[model samples]
Target: MSPADTGASTTVGARLPASPDSPTDSRMAPGGPGYRRMSLALFLAGVATFALLYSTQALLPLISGEFGVAAGEASWTVAAATGGLALFVLPMSALSERYGRRTVMTASLAVAVAVGVLVPFAPSIGALVVLRAVQGAALAGLPASATAYLAEEVRPRALVTAIGLFVAGNSVGGMSGRVITGWVAQEWGWRVAVGVIGALAVACAVAFRLLLPAPRHFTPGSLRPRVLLGTVRDHLANPLLRRLYAIGALFMTVFGGVYTVIGYRLTEQPFGLPQGVVGSIFLVYLVGTVSASTAGRLVGRLGRRGALYLAGGTTAAGLLLSLGDRLALVLLGLVLITAGFFAGHAVASSAVSRTATTGRAQASALYQSAYYVGSSAGSTVGALAFHSGGWAGTVGVGLLAVLGVVGITLCGTRAARVAARREPVPAH
Candidate 1:
């Protein structure tokens, strides 16, 4: 069955129901004391997580120039960080389950920011990549823990708005980080640019610690291998969930590849844009923020499969448009690509939540893993494609990934139809 037909709650920003041990009155609500603090704390945490995670992306060309490395080799700085996050996120989530979300998030931010501080000081390309990988692994705790914390501590009625604020922070962080780094790196060099981001992350982390209210309704979960493995196996076994996971991965592959290589494309040949101008181009990410927020409405109007198709088509068109030499066309293409990717991601991820009947956290974690793995792959492969075949090669990779999304969505539509036909007839 399609995700909308699953009879599951599909609100993208909504959390799981509160635990029975936690009374509704005890949870934070919209107007309750500490609500704003809790919201701001998590918001800052989100900012720190993403801003630090992607700080090097806008500086890839500079990194390449500094180290005399190829684009594909420099891309590892981005790939290694995402790969580390993918590898460690599950284990970190398990830790949060046992230790508590607030503790895990606080510790994660502390470590990630510490690593961020050291990143600007790396003397070699290898050292920088290693530091970034460590920083990514350290940041893994924030995503799942922040969501779980909200589920446990915030009222169900106010959950969506609270989570929305945190997500907004992520968008702002990503855009501002790239933009800030672009201009900063232009004047002060990439090292100082990264150092500025590190300092910003430190401020965010400190405010997160001070402003976040203590969790009043946390219940510790088990850490047994057998239990966790069994849950993961069950999630992987579900066909619908499997498809949603693949969809998420494919969408991210397109996004990761395009953004990773765009810097090189704009800085070379006919475009020859300045570092700050190239960085400002990432303001297209703001389109993603809007598109992702409207995904629920799009799904409501178009159904899940229809929304996927539209997103794919939009992405493919963007890829084609971006092949031109005109700078305006390239910028417009980027905006379209950003919008399509974020909308598709929002739909697929929400579908994963709706499809899983139990072990929802594990289900989401698996999706997160696939998503970041795709990011790492895209960063590495996209740069390789660009190195070999220029802008067209990078666009080729994205188009193929978008095709994968469409093909998978088609399979889902077929499966839903087959399932519908097999249902038993009701008494007339």
Candidate 2:
């Protein structure tokens, strides 16, 4: 929504401090108690949202068996939630902008946990899919609001580090959710596994609520359609922002596609690994936790453009490696790809917050919406590809997608350079 729609225009009296980095009000600093608390809250937010959302992923085989559905259909359990998250992210971001960040985020966590608590009780496959979709929609609140919250409240110099830590939480959460659920499902049954995850989500949600500091710098706005539409127009018109959004979409497509069917791939064929062993492969996500933090440092050292190029190259290399037939090579490839994915995501998301001139929440929301849309589409497509042509086809598609990302990013860079050259030089 537009600033006008936010009634931010009416509250123009509440202008941002002359310098964002130097807000008149006290802002959270890098190492203060408040800062640490905020980071922990966000980190737990990342954990709860991702863990609750993907908890069903590792149980697809068992779910399919109980539901009497195909793998692709079973995948809908994961897809439904992502689809719901994708659909509501923009609207939820608007809500957070209109109300307040901490309020929106805390509510999101509580609602997501509540919905997750209900999934184990779903009476049928259709009911479970419906509940998962609702759960996903509930989970949309965090990602939609987190980056914008960081942008508005954190010091500019410390922003990248904060984003990295938050994403590191996502990496750890995603990995742990799959591993825990997979192992638990093997022994106790899928219902018990999911119920345990929901319980964990409840605990994380409580921690998130207790630790999060309220937003000090946020200015609430009106949720008018005109304002929203105008804000969307501005971002879409920016060539660089458009390219960044595209990168988010393509990045997650490959990530989602690979992880969607990876369990099936490892368990079925030449590798012939057991379910728990298949789950262990996700431990590679710890590599992503490190790479995300490193990406922050890289951005500080090399700037966003340089960091993105390197991250994309790393992802491409990982995809190529995954084509190997040996089990060790496959695991190594997963580690590389997971690292590259988080690195690229951390950079791109921070870039969105940096790039937007206004409606920071909306910009972040748009990026997340694209991200989850890619996820939903990628999971389904990847499942279908794996079913048809095997892991070879899945990797092939991912490689092509990563290449497309590189091409777009490079083209955007060239355009920026050309635009720089065309600008008139100041008279000396």
Candidate 3:
């Protein structure tokens, strides 16, 4: 049932109903006060969540020096957080279903910031990894809840734009965080760099709490293990959603692989860029910001499948370009790849909400679970590949991963139809 059907009231900052008959009433209207508040808050959530989650990325080299580990092992500092997030995303989603989206998300930011603040202070590499892992687990609360909240509150027509903007916030946060941390680490130390990021995250979290409207559509649900399992099975059984899950995993695998090792590459030999300059490479993420923010219009014009194809192709093209020796070509390649990732992710993730008929939060949680698992696996494996064979091998793996996304998107759709035709009809 709709929120209106449940006779629920919105928080103070929410939009009024457009009328019972209008589709707009079923959603937060495109230009309403609630819509603005929701967008702003989620944008901040995206920034704070990702910024804190990935703050260690640009500092991996410094971390390697400080902790005296190989590049692959040092990369784990980034991997542990993602691994923890992957492990706990579903449970956090279940918690959101039991409590409320806003409450859960607000608390997530607060706790993650606390952890981020402590990460730079760990006495041992083992302790640092452990702290990062816990921080990752705490951070999982935002993605599932935020996606579910967008699905629940925003109108269908506005969903793509809303998701796009949210992703743009992610891109901007990632870029800014890396640049800030790298520059600061170059001048003073990695500890101060991370500490600054933690401070920014705290500020964003506070603003998020103040700007976010309370859930008008939330209906609390049982937290039974059986119910959670049933929801997972249902999402996995849906052909389109299943394909989307694959796409999410594959996309992040390639993305994580590329970014995880690129830092190591730029800091060595021919290019020999400084840590600060290497972090500047993330400035390419600005392209991602634009692409993500524009993805809604792209989907509108090309349809979801078409947009997915474009994104995959763009990423593949970028990976091929990155194989070059010239710095210009390499930077250009990074730009294309980053832009493709954000655009593709925005469309694909939003599609989950559009496709699910029930258990929207669970469905979103599953998607995020796939995404983070891909991140965890990709970071570890991608780094290993780079360690074994250098940039060529890394790009090769990334290209193959993108091809996998394309194949699944095209073939999976047809396979789903054929399977549907073979299902036996149930008698009434």
Candidate 4:
């Protein structure tokens, strides 16, 4: 179908089908063959990218101990990858626009797999950081391209369900990767662990290539100064997008910071947890599975703003709960945080994807770039809180970041009301 046919001249947002009548719904409609195929492909892609991206994080403590680096310095291993991913956000977004989502996402995962192999071989911390940074850059491809593919292909009626699955896959992959790699490092060594994660990513990349169908729709987008500036300005002009971006960044920032502090605190602590137990905390990510799917249902019933408010409050409450030192309380907190994060991410990401009239990948890339930037920035900064006031201070920072999301939620709700009143129903 041509852009003209789909109402691309304006933001149609995304409309999903009510029910998939056949296998084709996974492919061409919701719950049809196309969707199932793409969802599987996306699941594979998520597993591969996350396994490779976070494999280093699981081994950071070991890396620091082995290399005789301080805890703060050791974190660069993870930070380097995030920084690389951030720098390429717009470029990769443009690359997908110019080439295609299928090609770009496949290549992105492929390159990340290759880069994942090198981290285990770095002879020095400096070399590891460089490798990690390069790995981060390579990791940028999947996020923007994948999000765009979903936004474009999923029937608007089914869009929320599809996005929920993709985000769930991401959360699952991230949790599993950390646990898997951390365990492997504990049993064998960091090198072997890293190598295994890379190998898995390579395998999944191949699966993604085989499974993901060719896009039903795509349009070339330019990177020239005028074109790029216009596109950026167009997205920035959306009052809702700006607020979504802010909320996304702050949500991840606080959540990422919370996770970072918990790991370090558990490593020491009045609790004195081992790495294995620390890894087990990620098991609580199971809650995210439910929340991701539930959020989709919520969006249909609650509309956009109502869902966000629920997500924000869930996140804030979760962060507060985890502040307790009791092991049971901490695990419960992790569950709450996991559920809250997925819910918020699902709603905001879908909203961002919908808000754009064109270059949806670019829109998604910007959102994710900002999202992970928060992740990297939050996790890194949280370390300082650990150094200063310990876990309580760290929780304080995380909670404060959550407050930012609350403010964004309120602003977004108000603006959306105004826009709806003025414009009535959207073009789609």
Candidate 5:
């Protein structure tokens, strides 16, 4: 960040107005009802998007059985959305710069809702995948601005809390969507159950638009290829940011891969669970939600290095537990894996935001884009393994991925420590 640029944004941020209603906010001169509204909108969105998006996951076996597609092909129903989101994130970020975050995000939510409502009507598996792909792309904007909204609107002290709440929404949404779909599939049918979740998502989207406050500090984003590439290079060049991206990739890849096949696993052999039973498994996300909140305290005590190493090791343990044939072991393993992912992601996301104080939004955006890309890749690879090698193969790859995360953790911690030492102390 150049001095001129720093002065420009800081001057604007400093000029932010306060509401007359809240003397506390007026005293601190941070955000207003608008920022709070934005946060609320984002939180609700997390509930809707994840619920609607991953609802298909628990239904993977149903999709396979009904559509007569192979496990890998059915897996595309979920993977396609992730893949589309990966592609759309950057472009959506750019769109927000031009049209503004709230506008782009609201529109995106509407489109996603439309896609969800249309899902039950899809005549064939191919059509459903295509609609899912588009819906995934549409969802890209909501998550993209979600971070930018927080970073730009709230006080620095309050930003992490807001982000944490939004992520918590993701946990709740994912769990409910799967459970609802699974339960409904057991009683009604997969189409009606999934479609109802989608309808609820649409309602949530409308509420989001109505509730979210418009941006007060947003300026048009730069569309210049030169500037875009420069921003990309700047974030990528930062050692800590680079490592965080790598960690995000590794965790999501392995985590996504492992969970992607769980339905397949349960549907086979000793388990042979129904879709409702498979969906109930997502109740395990409750552990992940609890851990994500609790993990916040760890960053204050151990710092990123110790915290991340512990998390990576935890992730590995989770995968190892999944290798057991017993239902108890499988559930326990998933709980650990979800816990580790939330913890690791929380640490990594915080590290990246702190890496660049001025370009925080862009840095966070880059980080999230990599995160989803990892999800897409992981789901795809997990599908292939589930198809050919089965549970053991998926477990093998997941642990192997965690080993790489361990290496990244050691290397990154060493670098951050070196940088800390190199940073000069100012005279008191």
Candidate 6:
């Protein structure tokens, strides 16, 4: 069944009358009371989460010069953050289950923004990486909590659209943070650029808190270690979930590696682009936003595996195109890469949510953890490759990751065919 149809079925079940003591059946839907407020609040939360998370990415070159660090060392600033998020996301999700989604999200944003404010003042690269890691760990509560919140509060029929808006905010935040840092660092410095992003995050956090309605649908979940471990084990044991998780990680590996190294490439040699211009390159993320939103339609046309193949091919093509020295070709390549990465991520993440029947929250958390781990690995590995072998090295890494995605998808296709053959024919 289609993702929306599955959601609709779940919503229909949720709407059925229950005992008076049960949680209220009313849910936020398009045109329903509190819907706009909820959407806007969560959108802002998404903006704050991402803007603060990658605030340093566009400034990596500047950071390298100021700290007297190599490309790989400076990349730790990015990698550390993503690694922290990967390590802490599941624990944060567990906290959300025990406490409350809104509460956890509010606390997460508050701590993350606070850390963001401190980021610009770090005394050294080591301090900066530590602060970024702290900020990332703090922000981990937002993703799974926000998804759970929407699933519980928003009607299933409106779930996909609502989630899409949230994801769009993420894209906007990533693009704007990089662009803003690029120009601002050119004028003021990387410190001030990051400070500006921190301030923006503060504003988003405040707006988010003010606008979000209190949760009426949330029920406290068990925090027992055994239960959590069992849920995690069950999810890990599922081959489909394992494949989806790997696909997500591989897609993000390409995206994270490329973006992390692109600034360095542009600032050097053939391109000789200014910091502001390098930052503006992130505008290609708007293409990702569009591609991600249209993923469902793509799946409708191509089916899941087919859509994955298309995304993989698109990313591979982009990686190859980016090998060229021409500025225009590089920009177009980034556009294609962003589009493919976002679409693949959307498909893989959605598949995770659909695959897990009992532990949807934990399933999503695992996928997210894997996703960020890829980001972390990509940042470190990509930068190291660039340090030794230049832009070609980074592109080579991305291409290999794209190949991994394609390989996994092919395996999924073969498994599906095998499973189909194993099924008995329908009775006459």
* lDDT (CA) per prediction: 0.82, 0.83, 0.85, 0.76, 0.77, 0.85
Candidate No. with top TM-score = 2
Backbone clashes, each candidate: 0, 6, 0, 20, 1, 0
Which portions of model 3 miss their true places by more than 4 Å?
1-26, 415-428
Q: RMSD per prediction, one decimal?
A: 3.8, 3.6, 4.6, 4.1, 3.8, 3.4
Worst 10 residues of 1 by lDDT: 6-15
Query: For residue 169, what is the lDDT in candidate 6?
Result: 76
lDDT of 2 by residue, 90-173 (tens): 889989988888888888888888888789988888999999999999888889699888877776667778888899999888
Q: Give per-residue lDDT, candidate 2, residue 165.
A: 86
Q: Which candidate number maximizes lDDT?
A: 3
**In angstroms, how far off is 303's CA in candidate 2?**
2.5
- Displacement of residue 423 (Cα, Å) in model 4 is 6.7
- Tens-place lDDT per residue, model 5, 1-428, is 43222221121233344432234442112255466666667778888878866768888888888889987888888888888887888778777766777888888888888788888887889998998899889988877577776656665455545666677777778888988898899898889988889877887888888997666666676678787678778778877678888898888888788778988899789899877888889998887677665655777688668888989989999999988989999999999998888788777775565455444556767877788888877888888987789998888888887898899989977876797899789889
TM-score of each: 0.89, 0.94, 0.92, 0.91, 0.90, 0.92
Candidates arranged by TM-score, highest first: 2, 6, 3, 4, 5, 1
Candidate 6 local lDDT, 324-378, one digit each (tens): 9899899989989988888888778766655565555677789889999999999
Candidate 2 lDDT for residue 262: 89
Task: Pull out the clashing pairs in model 5.
Answer: 97-221
Models ranked on lDDT: 3, 6, 2, 1, 5, 4
Clashes of 2: 6
Model 6 scores a C-alpha lDDT of 0.85
